[model samples]
Target: MRLLVTGGSGYLGAAILKRAPATCELAATYLAHSIAQGNAAAFRVDVRDADAVNHLFDEFRPAVVMHAAAQMTGDQMLAVNGDGSRNIARAATRVGARLIHLSSDVIFDGEHAPYDESAPPNPISPYGESKARAERVVLDELPRAVIVRTSLIYGFDPLDPRTRQTLNGEMPRLFTDEYRCPIFVDDLADALLELAQHEFVGVLNLAGAQRLSRYEFGIKMANAFHAAPRFTGALSASYPGRRPRDCTLDISLAQKTLRTRLRGVDEVLQDLPGF
Candidate 1:
């Protein structure tokens, strides 16, 4: 299999690249930083630039494309996450490649809990709106694409950004009411790779088994890291803007669909040396 991974240097993308099959030929694209770990041929191409994305796709001509590139914040969120996904979908279709697009649980408004694959998107935040728009554009471009909606991705190898922030006292407080099913990066990566080798199409809810509040998750991570000055708990309403209260994904379909076991944060954090 010839696989192309966008955002190859990112946390999730790099995990996928590192865990890909040995027989598979790999290529990756990045906007700024090049992939430092994977053995794939790297190309620096921003996904927002349709021509650049098309040229890279035409050259690589991958059998499968994992569109993980996205912008979470700033004025370029729509351009990078929404329109950029469109570019990837178009390029994948042109190359006759199967596209697996990474989506977020934030797409939902959070009024409902335990969302399934059939749930419709009603984004509440800018990031959620961008990801939701990305999903729509990707599906419009390639109807056969797999839209894998996931939750907060956490890991301990290099430590996730959220955990890092908590450990270093970067964040003043963690929301006690905001709940999410934080998936282990390895589990998610493995699941994505397994999906890549299959013909599955349409949306799938892939997330951790346990649903936890941000405060609960943060506390566990901080405990594992043996950090001092714990993060104070606060309600979502305490913050300035509108935030999703609960975006827990129902991964029953994924549980039955793939062999990869999606472990919860508690199970994953047990891997720490003295946790």
Candidate 2:
């Protein structure tokens, strides 16, 4: 199988590329940073640029296009998340390639517990709004598209500064009340690849099994890595933008359908080498 991954240089995208099966041919686009050296072919294409997206699709002619690239930040989330997604969906549709759009749990306000695919979107932040919009566009344009909504992704990546800080004890503080289902990047990538082969369409919540506050996740990380660091808990209301208190997802559908199982925090932590 030939696959095209956008944001090939990003934390999650790069992880996906690294974990993908060797039997599958991979091509990807990098923005802001140069592509990492690997067996996969990397191209410099901006998802925001329709022409560039089309050119890459035409050149690669991938059977599956994983749209993992987005303008992902609290500041520029709207422009990059919403508009950039629209361009990618359109280009993918034109190329006759199946799309697997990565979305976020932020799309739903954290008021409800164990959100499912049918839960109505109640985005409280610009980032959430953009992802929600992207979901709509991709599904509307291509009914066969897979929309995987994940949360608080964490994994090892030497190039990622956030991971570096956590490992170095520079920034170990986490929000106590900001609960989310954090998925391991490798597991998510495996699930996405499996989803790409299935007939399932529409939105699917692909997150960890456990609902954990940021503080708890930090503790688990520290314990797993044998790098215990001080953690700080804060209320979500104290933050600038509006945020949901708890937005854990129910991955029952994913568990029933996909080959890979959604792991809990304990499972993830135990998998750590030194834990």
Return the TM-score for candidate 1, rounded to 2 decimals. 0.97
TM per prediction: 0.97, 0.93
lDDT leader: 1
Consecutive 10-residue window with the lowest summed lDDT within model 1: 222-231
Q: In model 2, which regions exceed 4 Å deviation?
A: 157-163, 167-173
- The digit string of per-residue lDDT tens for model 2 on 215-265 reads 788777766666666556667677777887889898998888888978887
lDDT of each: 0.91, 0.81
The model with the greatest TM-score is 1
Tell me the alpha-carbon RMSD of every candidate: 1.1, 1.9
> Which residue pairs show backbone clashes in model 1?
none
Error of 1 at 197 (Å): 0.5
